[model samples]
Target: MNNLIDELTPEEIAAGDVAITSELVPWHFPMMNDNVRNDAYEKALKAALKNGGTVLDIGSGSGLLSMMAARHGASHITTCDFVEMVAEKAKIITARNGFADKIQVINKLSTTLVPGTDFPERADILVTEIFDNGLLGEHALVAIEHARKHLLKPNAQLIPCGARVYAMCIESSEIYKNHRVETISGFDLSAFNQFSSYEYSGYHIEKSEHKALSKIASIFEFDFLKDTKDESVEITFEVTESGLCHAVVYWYELQLDKDTIISTAPYLPQLSCWKQAVQLLPKPMNLTKGETLKLVAHHDNEAIWFNRL
Candidate 1:
């Protein structure tokens, strides 16, 4: 009789290997924001301790959050990640912390993990720190929605119950010139313009506090338990000051509650994977200095992709 837990297929092994070895150790795409995680962990632990039930940590990058939940008196802890290497490392870390018996690590995506089927049961508390800089970059919403529908108990508590995308215009000639200008010193290197189109590059904001160039835009929202509707949230921004809108500067603000919120904007002096998702105009729009850029943010809930128009 072969138990499901002991059955590790070749496909699962390959996926795990690629995610852990490549994503977790050296090139962590969604870099851990320790401050955010620490804050969320403390809050979740308090909630979990009060409830005193099993916990599930999704996207368990290094098993730190799961371990915290276990130590905080969660009846049991289950951690899952799509990346194999990260899961392998997390297993080691969990075992090393003497929680091997109490905590289980599964190398699978949250969407595929079923409660009572793949896991012991529906976790009472679901804790995942999969947020990106502006709550749009990581698959946080997708993972949360999937878990809530399939793996979480009816009354399960979701850490970071909801999140918002906060963004405002900034004046950064340095970043614009860096991306917009193609040739310099008599070189015809226009072919290098492709890098500017890629949205992965993190930008530098000089000031720690920023005045609203326009009102802040709310790109998306996620309430873990409810059915998430699909519709593009349209926010139009009139460029008051006419510099190149190299891209819309983006960041994230988390609503722990009505009173407690954690904001990780570029001006906040914190490092996070939710870097700026810039949508540079295909052609640089030269405003007469006061021309409004009229930026429209388009969000697709299914694929979890956000783009500016």
Candidate 2:
């Protein structure tokens, strides 16, 4: 959100501690404060490290996961972050936490990591939390696939073994107004809507008033330990409530292990760091009960989107 940076006062921006481009600072705080997310990763790390092995942590913000691996008795840990500032802070954090001997922080992308040069050898465990609201928007598929092939040992354990994305059609003029520009105050402002995004945008669905028009539909599944490619598929949902479909709201369940799952479902009581993604349709479609809504769900290995068919 550029507004987060734009809202900063001149004095604050001039402060030595402030980073103008550090929009990620706001994100890191919420994620680190999320007990559900932190606890699940800790549990997964403990389970994955039961046999004792080295770990490779991608997107190591603050080096928290890497430190967790070290605490779980991982023999060695190598972590990386593409952001130079975050990587530097992670190194400082690891050292201050007394894990400097066990964890190595790299200021480079995981995609650029080379075995035997970046670290002693391929790691026996891979732990990472690089997902966005849409799951694939941060290129988790590309990074994980590359790690599996070049940075991890054969049969290496994955903290989040996989994930499944789900979507449901919704009717909410309140939400639609954010993306659509129509007649306002007797003036036609609809022409400005040409700049509106057709792609999905993240929102805290719990804070938004909306009515579900269709049952949730499973759209895609990804296995972190396996190689994957860009994919597109047609998914159909049966309308349960007769209403105008304004957008497709989507969320995901992250499978840390077979038994450990963290969900961003709007119905869940706990708030998640990752918000639900909403893809507003170009035009609202009126539907009756029992009608079928077909959507083409596609991911380009980085971002995800849905289109009415």
Please report how far candidate 1 places residue 148 from its true position, in Å.
1.1
TM-score of 1: 0.77
The runs of at least 3 residues in candidate 2 whose Cα sits more than 4 Å from the true structure, single-residue gaps closed, are 1-24
lDDT (tens digit, per residue) of candidate 2 on 1-309: 568668755544443245445565678988998999999999998998888999999998889999999999999999999887788778877887899999999989999999999889999998889999988888888889889999999988887889999999999898899889899999999899899988888888768888899988999998887787789999999999999989999999999988899998886778898899999999899989998988899987888898766
Best by TM-score: 2
Q: Which stretches of candidate 1 lie over 4 Å from their true place?
A: 1-24, 27-33, 177-181, 186-200, 207-215, 238-242, 257-259, 269-274, 287-292, 302-309
Task: Tell me the deviation in Å of residue 172 in model 2.
Answer: 1.5
Worst 10 residues of 1 by lDDT: 18-27
TM-score of each: 0.77, 0.92
Q: Residue 72 of model 2: what lDDT?
A: 92
